[model samples]
Target: MPDLPSGAVTFLFTDIEGSTRLVKQLRDRYAEVLAEHQRLLRAAFAAHGGHEVDTQGDSFFVAFASARDALLAAVEGQVALLSHPWPEGVQIKVRMGLHTGQAVATGGRYTGLAVHRAARIGAAGHGGQILVSQAAQTLLEDEEEDLHVFLRDLGEQRLKDLDRPVRL
Candidate 1:
């Protein structure tokens, strides 16, 4: 795994979709499913040079040196979850969001509007969806990598606590 960023970095937030329902639906087996979910997601993050910031329940906050790397981790995580075989017929889906901006890294944690914006973007997305902020999208625009083909223009989106709509 790559070193975790200590300064300005891209933030990636992920939450298991329908977690409450899954918890009740899976009951005793939920713990096993959750462990697998964490393993799968952490593997993707490691592969993409992401540093885990915090995780509470099914939500994870990760940091990456590059916005592209953060986005790649999100895609990789989603793809992994989509194909994972759950116990019984249960299913798990995750919603991920990414944003690139300056953050204050203190005590191994990041704080600032960038973190909040990243969380809001994650909340706005549905299961299996990857949402990127305008800043991040612009960073990837000049690149000719195959990743560009997977990005969907969601247009401008009004995020919570933000004063204006941002081009997504």
Candidate 2:
């Protein structure tokens, strides 16, 4: 495990919407949709040069070398999932968040406020929406046309366990 550079790294967090309810309702059917969702996300992330850091049930934590790639991957993932048909009684909506900041890398994993902030931002987004931190927004500010298609600013939010509010 090596320490990360002092500069900035991008983190992306995503979660499946209504996953618990859908699991309860679909029972056996949930497995199929979940598998498909995983496949799509993995492919899109790999294609966009994003590295998968961790996964917990229906949620994913990934890292990218740049904010642009992370945001693009998130947007593409949502679009891909939206275009797919789900199994009967199953819905596959996802909420994603991206943030760029200094982080520590150890044991092949990333840690620090940036990762936590990304998770919080993802939680703040609605299903099918992509939310980004102020740091990420700043990076994409000049690429309005490229960003307008998927990312949206939900404004500043006070995240749990953090002192100050983070813009998303």
Candidate 3:
């Protein structure tokens, strides 16, 4: 098993936007493009103390011990993707979300509202956008990092199947 936090953790979720259309548009070389994307993402994640949780196609779920590391990983991942030479001249954009909460990790799986909420926040974002929960924002404020993190308040948003609107 990877050295993931078993209790309190911050989750980062990422998804590729318009992946289906990109695949259709880039056809033969889409696989190579995606491979490069995954590689870049993994490198950024690893560099910033992130633990790989799950990844499918053009999405990734990662866990971090601190909000600082998680947020930095997200920002650096975006920077890397923007600078990569995408194959076949195809452009790609990704959305990311983060939420800090306690979760149960057993047998290599994470189950809890934190994870679900994180995924929903990611889904609600536009390509190249990052959405972070209020909990994560608080964590950010509590920790000082060398790199600055800036966020635009989205206010409380009603998320899919969530009981209360989450502050994003």
Top of the candidates by lDDT: 3
TM-score of structure candidate 3: 0.95
Model 3 agreement with the true structure over 1-168: per-residue lDDT tens digits? 675687779999999999999989988888988998999999999999898999998999999998888899999999999988776567889999999999998888899988999889888898888899999998787554455766778999999999999999
1-168, model 1: which lDDT tens digit per residue? Answer: 334585568899999999999999988888989999999999999999899989999999999999878888888898899999787778798989888888888777778888898889988899989888888887888762767546778998998888888666
lDDT of 2 by residue, 19-98 (tens): 99988888887888788999999888888888888899999998888888887888789888988887655568899888
Number of the predicted model whose TM-score against the real structure is largest = 3
Clashes of 2: 0
Models, CA RMSD each: 1.9, 2.3, 1.4
Model 1's lDDT to the true fold? Answer: 0.86
Per-residue lDDT for 158 in model 2?
A: 94
List the global CA lDDT of all models. 0.86, 0.83, 0.89
- Work out the TM-score per prediction: 0.92, 0.91, 0.95
Query: Which ten residues in a row are the worst by lDDT in model 1?
Result: 142-151
lDDT of 2 at 14: 91
Segments in model 2 whose C-alpha atoms lie over 4 Å from true places? 1-6, 147-151
Residue pairs with backbone atoms closer than 3 Å in model 2 (clashes): none
